[model samples]
Target: MLQSLSIRDIVLIEALDLDFGAGLSVLTGETGAGKSILLDSMGLALGNRADSGLVRQGMEKAQVTATFDAPDPASKLAVYLADNDIEIEPGEPLIIKRSVKADGGSRAFINDQPCSAALLREAGNRLIEIHGQHDDRGLINPRGHRALLDTYAGSDPAKVRQAFEGWQSAKVALEQAIADQEAAEQDREFLEHSVAELSKFAPQPGEEQELALERATMMKGEKLTGDLEAIRAAFDGSNGGLASLRAAARRLDRIGEDHPLLAEALGALDRAVIEAGEAEELLNKAADALMFDPQRLDDMETRLFELRALARKHRVEPETLAKLLTDMETRLAAISDGGRSLKTLEAGLAEAKSSYIAAAEMLRLKRQKAAKALDKAVAGELKPLKLDAARFETLIEPLDELRWGGNGMDRIEFLISTNPGAPLAPLGKIASGGELSRFILALKVALAEEGGAGTIIFDEVDRGVGGAVAAAIGERLAKLSKAAQLLVVTHSPQVASKGDAHFLINKSIAGTVSRTDVAALDGEGRRQEIARMLSGADVTDEARAQADRLLEGV
Candidate 1:
C-alpha cells in the first residue's frame, strides 16, 4: 500500500507531506481547494508527463515523492524489480521520486537510484493505480481486459504459453527442414556427380606426401643410374680390389712362418680382404635399387597432379580430401532420406499445434465461465450506484488463428448499455462522464480481491450521486479497502464519512502567494468538515446531528 506522499513546490502546494494507511482515506474540501493539484503531484511522482506550469512561481523546480510498502515476494511487482536488478529488502519501502524543471523537463528515481521515466512508470504502475473521471489507461485499456479476466477467473496462462512455445519450436524446425530439402533438391545432380568421382578416386591421408617423395626419387635415379653402374663395375671381377686383396693375403701367409713381424702383416692383409668383399656386396645392392621403369614415373607424376587439381577444386588441403568426401556423401544421404525426416518434423508440428489448441480451448472455457460471473457481479453493483437501467456484459470474442497468442484465442472486452433496449457499446462510447465513473466503480467493485495494485486512487467517483447512491459507493470503496488501500477525493459528505482516515484540503492566500494545505481530521474536525459538506460553507446544528449519525453508522 502507499505509505506516504510528499510534495514540494508543486503549483499551490508549496510543501505538503501526507501519510496514508491501509483502508479508504478521503480528501474533502471546497471547490478550487487544490484537490486536482494534489492528484497531479502524485501523478508526476508516478512518472506522468511533467508540465512547467506545475512548478510554483519563482521556484526552480517541483518535486514529488511517493513511497509504498514492499510488495509480496512472489508478486508481479517484486518480480519486475528483480528483473530490473533493483534490490529491496523484505521490509524496505519502495520510494519513487520525480522532479520537474521549470523548462518542462523531468527526472525520475526509484529508491534514490536514477532511472528512466519509462522504468519509473512501470514500477509506479505496479505500486499504485489512479482512476479519474476521464481515465482511459490502466484498467480501462481494452488490451488488458483479457489478462484481467484471466486473473478474475484465477486461470493460469503458463500452460498456454508453454504449449505455444512448443508449437513455435516445432514449426521452426519443420520450416528449416523444408528449406534444406528444397535447396538439396536443386543441387541433387551436382552432389551425385561429386560423390561418384570422389568414390572412384579414393584419396587417402598422407598419400600426396608419399607420391611426391617417390616421384622425386625416381627422377633423380633416371639421371644417376649410369654413374651407379660405373661404380658397380669397379667392385665386380678379378681385377677389382677384393680379388687383388685376396692374392696379397695368400703371398703374405707363405712368409708368415719366417718372421714374427711377417705373421702380424699376414693377419692384417686377411682382415683387409674381408672388409673389401663387404664393400663390393653393398655396391651391388645400390645398383639394383637404382633400376626403375620409365612408365612408373609417368603414372606417379599424373597421380600427384590429379591430387593437386582436386584439392584446388574443393578448396581444401590434399590431406583433407578424404574427410571432405565423407561429408559430401553424408549430405547426399540426407537428401535421399529427407522425405522421412520431413514427415517426422511435420508430424511433430501437428502434435504441438494440437496441444496448443487444446490448452487455448480450455482457457477459453474458463474465461467464458468467468465472464458470466463477472457480468452478474457488475449487474448487482449497478442499481445501487444509480445505474439501475444499465446492463454490463463481458464480451468474449474469438480471435483469428493469425492473431492467437499465449493469452489464448479470445478477445475480451467490457461492454455496457446505459439504458433499456440500448445497444451495448464500449464504456467510453455509451456512458456519460458521470455514468462512466459509476461504471468504473461497478467494475472495480465486482473485481474486488482480484489482482491489482496495492493502492487505488479514485477522483470523485460519487460526483453525480448523493444520499443512498453516495453511501453505496462509499460502502463498496470500504469493502475494496479491505483487500487493498483506497484514497478517494470527494465532495460527498456520505463518502467522506466512510473513510477510516479523512483529510481536508484548504486554500489560503498569504501576502501575494496562494498556498494549498491538507489537514488530517480528528473526530470534532471530521464532524465539522462533514457538516460543512452537508450545509455548504455553513455548520448548522442539524447538519452536525446528521454528521454524527453518519459517523455512528460507520
Candidate 2:
C-alpha cells in the first residue's frame, strides 16, 4: 500500500507531506484547490513524464517522493528492485523519488539509488494502480481485455499456451526434417557415386608417410650401390696384389729370424695384407645391401602419387583423407536410413499436436463457463450504479486456427449494451466516460481479491455522476477498500463520508509564494469537509445532518 507522498516545489505545491493508510481515503476540497496538482505530483513520483513548467515559479526544481509497504518480503516489487541493483532496507518502505529541473532535465531514484525513469515506472506499477476518469477508461482497451478476463476467471491459461507452443515446435521440426530428406533424396545418386569412389581407393592411415620413406631409401640406394661396387673392385685389385705381398712378407720373415729390424718390416707388411682381405669382405656385404629391387621403388612412388591426387581431388590434407572417407560413409548410411526416421518424426509431431488440441479444447470450454459467470457478476453490479437498463457481457470467441501465444486460443472481450434492444459493442467503442468509470469499478469490485496487493487511486470516479448514483459509487469503493487500499479524489459528499480517512486540499499564499496545503481531518473536521462538499462554498445545518447520516451509514 502507498504509505506516504512528499512533494516539493511542484506547481502550486511548494512543500507537502501526506501520510496514507489502508482502506479507503478521500481527498476533497473546493474548486481550484490543487487536487489535480496533488495527483500529478503523485504521478511524478510514480515515474510519469515531467515538464519544467511543473516547477514552482521561483523554484529551480520540483521533486516528488512516494513510499510503499510491501505485502511480503519476496514480493515482485522487491525482486524487481534487487534485479535493478536498488537496495531496500529490511522491513523498510520502498521509497521512489523523481525530480525535474527548470531546464526539463529529470532524474528518478529508487530507495535513493539513481535509476532510469522506465525502471521506476515498472517498479511503481507493482505497488499502485491509478485510475482517473480518463485513465480508468483504459480498461476498455481490447488488448488488456483478455488478461482481465483471465484474472477474473482464475484459470491458468499458461498450460494450454505451453502445449500449443510445444506442438508448433514439433511441427516445425518435422517440416525441417521432411525438407532435408527430400533434398537428400534428390542427391542420392551423387552420394552413392562419391561413396563408391572413396571405398575403391581404400586409403590407409600413415600410408603416405610410409611410402615417402620407402621412395627416399630406394633413390639413395641407386647411388650407394655403385660406390659399394667400386670399393669391391678396388679390394680385388689386379696382378695378385694382396697374394704377392703376403708371399714376400713370409719369405722376409724366415730370413729375418736372424735380423730383428727386417723381421719388424715383414710383420708390418703381413698386417697390411690381412687388412685388405677384411676390406674386400665388407665391400661385398655392402653391395648386396644396396642391391634393392627397382620395381619396388616404382610401386612405392606410384602409391604415394595416387594418395596425393585423391587428397587434392577431395580438398583435404593427405592425413585427413582417412577421416573424410569415414564421414562420407556415415552420410551415405544416413541417407539410406532417413526415410524411416522421417516417418517416425512425422508421427511424433502428429501426436504432440493432438495433445495440444485436446488441451486447448478443454481450456476453451472452461473459459466459456468462466465468461458466463463473469458476465452475470458484472451485470449484477450495473443496476445499483444507475445502469439498470444496460447489459454487460463477457464475449468469448474461439479462434478458428490455433494461435501459438502466451495466452490460450480463445479471444475474450468485454462487450456492453447501454440501452434495451441496443446492439452490444466493444466497451471502448461505445461506452461513454461515465459508463466506462462505472464499468471499471464493477470489474475492480469483482476481482478485488484476485488483483495483486497495491494501492488503488481513483481520481473523480464520481465524474458525470451525483445524487444516489454517486452514493452507490461511494459504497462500492468503500467495499473495494475492504480488500485493497483505495484513495479517491472527489467532490462528492457521499464518497467523502465513506472514507476511513479524509484530507482537505486548500491553497494559500505565503510571502508572495503560492502553496497547496493538505490537512488530515478528525471527527468534526471530517464532518465540516463533507458538509462543504455537500453545500458547495457554504456549510448548512441540513448539509451537516446529511453528512452525519452518510458517515453513520458508512
TM per candidate: 0.92, 0.86
Per-residue CA lDDT of model 2 for 173-260, tens digit only, reads 8889788778887878877887788788888888888888877777877978777766666646555566677778878878987889
Instruction: Give the per-residue lDDT of model 1 (tens digit) for 1-554.
Output: 89999999999999999999889999999999999999999888887888989999999999998888877888888888778877778888888889999977898888888888888888888788888988887767888888889999999999999999999999999999999999999988988998898889999999999999888877777888888878777766888767788888888888799999999999888888788778777767765665666898889889999999999998999999999999999989999999999999999999999999999999999999999999999999999999999999999999999988887888889998998999998877888877888888888888887868888899989887899999998898988889889999998999999999999999999899899999999999999999999998768999999999999999
Clashing pairs in 2: none
Worst 10 residues of 2 by lDDT: 231-240
| C-alpha lDDT of residue 302 in model 1 | 91
Best by lDDT: 1
Provide the lowest-lDDT 10-residue window in model 1.
284-293
Cα RMSD of all models vs. native, in order, equals: 2.8, 4.7
Model 2 error, position 488 (Å): 0.5
What value of lDDT does candidate 1 attain over all alpha carbons?
0.89
Query: The CA-based lDDT of model 2 is what?
Result: 0.83
